[model samples]
Target: MNDLQWYRLYSDSEPIVEKELLNKLLSNGALAKFALVRHNGEYKAMLYVNGKRINGPALPEPLTTPNGEVTHWMGNKPGVGLTTSEAEMIIQAVTDRIERAR
Candidate 1:
């Protein structure tokens, strides 16, 4: 799928950082960003957006109830986060979305 379509799919299903906070991060050009990654066969919502070897805070993971309710966990831990390619894709997708929305 294309970037926008892929973004819509992922955004709908996967857990991401809070929109407001993410927007702030992007606006500030923060090197670290937030993302959900699959690790050891389980999904991990990382605390920060990591590129290369840089590290940052850990945010709570996203959880969905059986009834489709969504909530965040209250913990932060370091883990292998998104790959460089994945981060680039996410950035491009977000940027494309913002531009299209304008």
Candidate 2:
């Protein structure tokens, strides 16, 4: 994958967020080290993992019930640029979270 090419997590049906993956990510201790920022009234997260920048919209604080769903879609596109290692880490993290959630 291109280092500058943005990519979003997806399941067999829809995007990973549609499966409430954000909740799983939020609850993961490995993800807690990132910094959350509010940009233009929206929350975004920035983390340097595996020597690459991992960034994307953040789940709203004081998460809501039934999923705490918060998706960032700009013009029908939802993703962020990441390096190969960063992308692998994200995928691994999500996979681990999914397995734990099962």
Candidate 3:
């Protein structure tokens, strides 16, 4: 799918650039900033945007997106997106678990 919407959370940190962990945090909403990352003397495009919370804390992973694809260049790679499917899934899972418990 088109990943909910545009995206959120941008960063060039090793954790973000080294691993593509957006999907994990996408469920858990967040507020962050990102910039061009220089790793191993090489520049990768864009990595990923963390997200608002909708599930348990995301586990650590070696995540990072390669090549910062630019659809609209506003200078200095930065973007945002909103994915829906994953959010919905988290919501359902949480609700079901709660109802079953009650």
Instruction: Please name the candidate that would achieve the greatest lDDT relative to the true structure.
Output: 1
By lDDT, is 1 or 3 better? 1
lDDT per residue for candidate 1 within 1-90, as digits (tens), equals 889987677665644333322311332454444454432333333445334322332334333432223233322333323333444444
Estimate, for each residue in 28-89, the C-alpha lDDT of model 3 and write its tens digit.
46443222323333333233344321221221111144233312211122333323443334
Task: Estimate the TM-score for candidate 1.
Answer: 0.26
Cα deviation of 64, candidate 2, in Å: 36
TM-scores vs. true structure, each candidate: 0.26, 0.26, 0.24
Query: Each model's C-alpha lDDT?
Result: 0.40, 0.33, 0.31
Candidates 1 and 3: which is better by TM-score?
1
Cα distance off (Å), candidate 3, residue 49: 11
Each model's Cα RMSD: 14.1, 16.8, 18.8
After TM-score superposition, what is the CA distance of residue 53 in candidate 2 from its true location, in Å? 17
TM-score between candidate 3 and the true structure: 0.24
Span of ten consecutive residues with least summed lDDT in model 1: 18-27
